[model samples]
Target: MVTSSSLVYLIGLPLFGAVFLLLMGRKADKWGHLFATAMSAGSFVLGLLHFFAMTNRSEEERPITQTLFTWIEAGDFKVDAALLLDQLSICFVLLISGVGTLIHIYSISYMSHDENRRRFFAYLNLFVASMLLLVLGNSYLNLYVGWEGVGLASYLLIGFWNQKPAYATASKKAFVMNRVGDMGLTIAIMIAFATMGTVSFDGVKEAVDRVGTPTLTAMGIMLLVAAAGKSAQFPLQAWLGDAMAGPTPVSALIHAATMVTAGVYLIVRSNFVFDAAPTAQLLVVIVGAITLIFGAIIGMAKDDIKKALAASTMSQIGYMIVAAGLGPAGYAFAIMHLLTHGFFKAGMFLGAGSVMHGMNDEVNMRKYGGLRKMMPITFATFGLGYLAIIGVPPFAGFYSKDEIIATAFNSGGAQGIILGSVTLLGAVITAFYMTRVMVLTFSGKPRWDDGVHPHESPALMWLPMALLAIGSVTAGYLFTQGEALVHWLSPLFAKKGEYDELMPHSVVTVLAITAVIIGVTAALMKYQFKSVDSVVPTDVSLATRLARNDLGQDVVNEALFMRPGQALTEGIVAIDERVVDGAVRGIGAMTVGSGATLRRTQSGYVRSYAALILLGALVLLAGIWVVTQ
Candidate 1:
């Protein structure tokens, strides 16, 4: 039987941990991280139990909701603070709590040396709690609360080392850019409420057919904007790379596994709206296509290991967004990829942290070479993640990513062909850049800086990496080999037979493999035996220069948004000072001057006061006599 209170514990445990840690302050420093890790593991355990309970029920009876209390009530409008546990949300819950548990464990060792480790664990608990809320909410308003909660948690974690100006700036940038998306979400919610008189998912789904197409289109586009901002899609993606300024476990948790996946979850959860608005769905495809390529190009030029991985994350998320836009045919696959990505990407990020721990916290790939011997466990685990991400057969990414590409081809028409080709090319580029990272960081002659020593990390760190690597290798096959995930997620999406393929699955698979081979071959040919310089050179080609500058995204943002915004702000300030404040000041000055004149007339002499009173009375009497005449 499905328990009503299970969902509450899923979200509540981590929050309890956070509050407990926060209340304990530094007093709990000795065991705070361990407590946080235990809380995360507990949430995951509850999630697993709940998942089994839901699976025992028939598909129609799978979705279970629990209403805690009324959150808002005004006239005809009302919303409940409720949680939904169904096929879709269940997937996300496991991913968040499961991967989050591992990240928390990794952070214990990764952040062992820091003075404020307790605070860091607290932030991790908060992040997990927020993400759980985001996916489990039964209503859009509830989702938004969780959404902003995740954003706030990310800012706190990203800027945890607030001593550095760059880290603080990155946190602020992430917050501001996400706000731009949050506004879109807010507008979408308002439109949903205004047009349909409901903000709950079930209510909207029931009412969507009756809503006008234009309104649906607007909702879809606005939702896409929100997704792009949170997921780091094109135009709003510049902040993600800089987010690497945080500790590596932060990168693993927030950027790789949890927070960045919020966008994909949002789109998938709102599939009913996008299914009705083809134009909006088309825009999602376009954004994904552009960003996948955009992220790949930037990834190719990045010298920092974390920045390269961050770029790869953008590209990979772009693929998932593309799948989500393909309508029902792609939602399940999008989620599958998202789950697998959480595994492999988090493993790789943690692997990067392990490398950094060994190498005096160096991030530049140029400073690393042939440390595979020095850190065998890290190398082995990172390689598995790398293979999975590159879509090699039998690895997790192969099943999920190849399915996306094949589904793209199945979209049919010139649009399908074009999108398919672009995605295929992205696969090639992904291989090249990811291979470059592995080869540079683990292969070739040692190019370490003088006197720098490298060694292995503690079991606390590598042990989690090993577990994630196992997932990276096996998750793909288990999910897709027999369309197991597709069937499992069927209740959330349309039937599989409804989608038609433009090409045979085998042909598409062959094409995808070929692309991977080409990319891997190109990377090996260029860097296999080559030694990299410890310092980056100032001189470069134009394309290289562009890549190094993130294709001038900052410049474009400044020119298109920042400068114009600054000018508008300056004008508003001027108007406020001269027009608004000036009017108030002028009125105040007049009142003060009139008071001064009246004061002069009221000179302390009793004769003067009496004379003024007589004059006033005489004038009043003369006016009264004239009126009477």
Candidate 2:
């Protein structure tokens, strides 16, 4: 591997922009947004240069690292403040910087009217810089810094309009839940250092096989916990829908395009550990499978456009997670889905923002209807994205998501059958909910409120959506052409030796396609052919109510964890105040009582001393006589 000093610029440029904007405060308001966009664009350009350089190098030398200093050192342990750029890291670099730049441009128009647009841009720059650090860090310890950085930035952006009490609460919910995941990562890193005696990627790779499966499994589970929080998988996914309380640009950049995929990246990066630990691998698959359906079911019942998309994001990330967990056969496909997902999902989010722009920031899809004629650019861009997400032919998701399903089936056992069925089920539900979004938002009769007028967004906003829409249509085909991405990433993974397929690839594709059609048809029959209620129906089934409330995830949490946690905390406080403190107070009272009894002996010392001396002399004479006898 080649060593270079230039990788720092990829993160530094954006970080500098953020610091500069924040330091200047109101003085930079006129220029901050533009400057932040330029910084992100510059990082993207730098990533391109490094990517080209990697392409020119021989396969074995494509990976490069830069060590700035020793970050930590103790007896028999060391970690460096360093950067890594290889086939895998390079993908994230481009995606974070490139898509991030587009979101910045979109925000330039989106948040122009807000009073704190300058600070908003600064947070955007900070977020991009932090995510770059996450992907570029050479060691897990170094990556933790970036991980926390991204979390902080997300909290800032999500609560940017913290004036609203609900928005503030939403941001806090996301922050606290993510910290739960971060603890898992912290433990995993400690395990690596304790067992393997190293925390760097190269070191971990070498030591994975040397360690036993139980240790690896433990490490893998911890890593999965981290991934679950960041990626919004089952049980840890409740914070995601509420996270849509953020601005649309933040949704596109942080939730859809970049930050949400951190888990998938983490899993793929730790392929060696998962490959060695079969039980851990199975657990990863289980989490993914459960979340895929969990998110899809919730998406089906959402009336808020952004929340619906957020649920879809959760489900898609599940697909990537399942692929990543399937060992070597899936590593590349998982990343492929992630990259393509970034393009389409970010574009669709931008499209949603444009619709909201025209409709006075209303988020309810139930209030929208026949907007296709009013917002042509949004309709076209969002339509492409919808097709891609539903696994339509010649679209991005088809190539990437299809391969994931095929790989799940190829695992070869009852496990394969269950997994493959679960993936196809997820696909069906995905199509239904996404199609439901389309029908309610852009199709059917006009249901908008009075005084509402819909129009296309300004060029500054739609232009980014346009660009991302193009990527949505083309990225998958490009990735799969001649197996391009798989080969590029193949060198990093242990060989995926030949294995028997439970079914033919063609058969799997057919099944996935058929499932999608059924879903689309089901949604259309209910929502398109039948009239949709302009107001959400209260007289619905128990299942619909459950889905509407995110499967009562919050209720479950309150019952299972939050309430119990609060009671436990109260009990601990009681013990400290009564049992622990009362004992100490009792000891203090006893000491005070003893001291009081002795105090009288010291009063009026002269007379008291004479009497005491006389008594002592008499006692001494008596003792001497007794001794003589």
Candidate 3:
């Protein structure tokens, strides 16, 4: 059973580690890696034990919940710091802890040279703890705490290189943009509480099921806003590409497993509300489909290795959102995709980090060529991730992405078909860009400037990449054919239904073959063995500029948010300096002038003062006597 006590360990251990790190100070450096790595690994192992133990329990025993204590108690209102253990929560627990441990190990080498290793690990641990709270919380309030915590951690990690102004700006952008989404989430929660009289998942779901369509629509849209900002969708997603200002491992976590996935978590958790609001569901599909294609196109044009990956992440997240809109079964695939995406995407980012490290911190793919010879492990691991992501056969990404696409086709109407089609195009684009990345970064020739030295990453860094690479290769099989994952996940989607009708082996095989042929052919004709002197453009036409600029969504946000924010700031400052402050200063000046005039009447002679005092006393006495009369 997931008692409040069980959750306490999930969150408290990392905090304890953070506290211990503070106590150890400099002495914690060498031991700090060991301690942090052990803590993360230990937490992961514990989570697995809990998951398996729950699986073995009776069906009635599976949904164990532990409420430690009441957090807020008001009239007919109470919120508990509760932890919920269910099939869904167990899945997330595994992903967070498993991926988290590997990233920690990788960081030991990647950030060993940093001045703030202690702070880095501290934030990292804190981030893990917060995400656990977010996923395991039984109430919306509990989730919000973790939601904000992750936001805080993101800001801290994104701006880890605080000396750089760009990094600081990127951090601010991320935090502020998320606040916009948080506001929507908060409002939705307040409405849910007022209407339903509770913020717990069961209460909200029951309430939403009874609420009117308008209310549901409003709530769903606000929830989408929250998800969009957190998951880096649409206009809100612009910040993520710039977020490459952080260290590479941080990028891996934010993009792959934790932060971006929070939005999906929120939507999936509130699937009941979304199910009731067809309009909101449509919006989700529209946003997801739009972002997917847009991100893919932008990714193609992107030359920076990390930025391209960031764009790719945004695009893939779109698929998940679309899946969520397709109904509960589709939502299950969304989560599945989320897990698989975390494996491969994180590997890809870490692999990029390794390349960056090897190439003396050069991230521009244009400068990296023929790196496969220098860093074979990175090339191979990252290549596996690329293949998996492009939905190649027998890879983890294909199963999830394909299910999402097929669901879109089945559940959605013509509009749904349109979203699916665009998504398919995005898949094609994703394949091309990723191939370009692998080829340009690791194949051809070394275009790095003179004096640049390159080599493989340390074992600590490479090991994580290797693990994720293996996962990328094998994780899909677990979903499609593996007994363990499916049986374990059965409870979560069993009630909704299965995609048995959709999973024709012949169809999947054809899709995989098609993806590989298109991906490989485009890469060969456009980049492979092509003279470096005459590089060919991958774009089929220039008409697709809308996708290049993220479908101009950023411009729309600037109009809707950026311009207004700027105008408001300027207007407030003008009023403060010219009107409000002027009025206050003017009052001060008038008071001073009155005081000067009053001083002028104050003569230095004692007789003058005495006469004035006598006159004032006589006037006061006369006024009192007249009143009495």
Each candidate's clash count:
0, 0, 4
Worst 10 residues of 1 by lDDT: 493-502
Candidate achieving higher lDDT, 2 or 3: 2
Q: Look at candidate 3 and tell me the lDDT of residue 177.
A: 89
Q: How does each model score on TM-score?
A: 0.94, 0.94, 0.90
lDDT of 2 by residue, 454-476 (tens): 99999999999999999999999
Q: Name the regions of candidate 2 deviating beyond 4 angstroms.
A: 581-629
Q: Which one wins by lDDT: 1 or 2? A: 2
lDDT of 1 by residue, 5-122 (tens): 6688888999999989999999999999999999999999999998898788898888888888999999999999999988988988998999899889888898999999999999
Q: For candidate 3, which ten residues in a row score worst on lDDT?
A: 531-540
Lowest summed lDDT across 10 adjacent residues in model 2 is found at: 599-608
Error of 3 at 392 (Å): 0.6
Question: With candidate 3 superimposed using the best TM-score fit, by how many Å does residue 292's alpha carbon deviate from the native?
Answer: 0.6
